[model samples]
Target: DVKVTQSSRYLVKRTGEKVFLECVQDMDHENMFWYRQDPGLGLRLIYFSYDVKMKEKGDIPEGYSVSREKKERFSLILESASTNQTSMYLCASTLPAGLAGAETQYFGPGTRLLVL
Candidate 1:
C-alpha cells in the first residue's frame, strides 16, 4: 500500500517557539508536499520538493520551510509558531509520472496543531 506517515497526530505549541513536523512515505515517490488546511480556506500549500535536496516555496511559505534529504522523507519546519499558524497540517506524496504535479495528490491523515 502507498502510505504516508506523519510524526504527530496532534500538536500544541506556544507562540515564538520552533516546531518540527516530519513525514515519510514508504512508496519512494519522487514528489512530496506540505499543506495547511483551515476551516473555510481549504488546503493551502506551504512547500514542496520534487527531488532529493531540491525544494520550492508554495503559496504560504512565509513562516515555514521544508527539507527533503532523502527520497522517502520530508520535513516541515515552523521557524516560529504563531496563533495564525495553528491549523491542520497535511503531508502528501504522488508518483512522478501521472500525478506528481497534476490535479490529484494522496494525503496523510493530517496533524492537528494548535498554537497558544
Candidate 2:
C-alpha cells in the first residue's frame, strides 16, 4: 500500500518568508505532485516530479519551486511567501502511467499554510 505523509499539518508564515513543504511516500512511487487547494478554485497543481532531479511546472507554478532528491521524498519551496499563496497544500504520489490503476494517487493529510 502507498502512504503519503507531509512534514506539517499546519503552518504559519509571514510575508516574504521562505516556506518549505516536505512530502514523503513509502511505496517508492515514481511520480509525485504538489497541489494547492483553495475555496472555489479547486485543486491547482503547483509542481510535479517524475524522477530524481527532474521536475515539471504545473498549472500554477509561479512563486513555487520543487525538488526531488530521493525516490521517496519531494520538497516544495516557496521562495517568498505571499498572502495570496496561503492555501492548503497537498502532496500526492502515484505509480507511473500505463500500469493498472496507475492513476490512483495516494495523498497526504495536507498542510494548511497561513501567510500573514
Candidate 3:
C-alpha cells in the first residue's frame, strides 16, 4: 500500500515566525503537491514538485515554498506565518500521467495551522 504521512496534525505559530510542514510517501511517486483549503474557496494549490529538484509555483504561492530533495519526501515552508496564512494544508502524491491510476491522488491527513 502507498502510505502518505505528515509531520503534524495541528500546529500553532505566532505572527512572523517561520514554520515547516513535512510530508513523506512510501511509494516512489513522481508528482507531489501542497495545497491549502478554506471553507468557501475550496482547495488551492500552493506548490508542487514533479521531480526531484524541480518545482513549480501554484495559484497561491505568494506565502509558501516547497522542497523536494528526495523521491519520498517533500517539505512545505511558510516563510513568515501570519493570521491570514492559517489553514488546513494538504500534501498529495500520485503516479505520473499515462500510468494506471495516475489520475488518483493519495493525500495526507493534513496539517491544521493557526497563526495567532
Candidate 4:
C-alpha cells in the first residue's frame, strides 16, 4: 500500500519563525510536491522535485523552498513564517508523469499552520 505521512497534523508558529514541513512516502515515487491550500486560492504548488537534489519552483515559490535529499522524503521550508503564510500545507508523491497511475497522487494528512 502507498502511504504518505506528514510530520505534524497541526502547527502553531509565530511570525518570523522558520517552519519545516516534512513529508514522507512509502511508495518510492519519483516525483514529490508541496502545495498550500487556501479557501479561495485553491491548491497552489510551491515546489516539486523529480529527482533527488533536483527541485523546481512551482507557481507560488515566493517565501518557500524545498529539499529532496532522499527518494522517500521531501521537506518544505518556509524561510520566515508570516500571517499570510498560514494555511494547510500538503505533501504529495506520485510516479513520474506519462506513466500509469501518474495522475493519482498519494497525499499526506496535511499540516495546518497558523502564524500568530
Best by lDDT: 2
Residue 69 in candidate 1 has what lDDT?
88
CA lDDT of every candidate: 0.92, 0.95, 0.94, 0.94
Per-residue lDDT of model 1, residues 5-38, tens digit only: 9999999999999999999999878889999999
Q: Which is better, 1 or 3, measured by lDDT?
A: 3
Q: Which structure is stronger by TM-score: 2 or 3?
A: 2
For model 2, which pairs clash?
none
Off by over 4 Å in 4: 99-102
In candidate 1, list every pair of residues with a backbone clash: none
* lDDT of model 3, residue 18: 92
Q: Which structure is stronger by lDDT: 1 or 2? A: 2
Cand. 3 Cα-lDDT: 0.94
How many angstroms is residue 31 displaced in model 1 relative to the true structure, after the best TM-score fit? 0.4
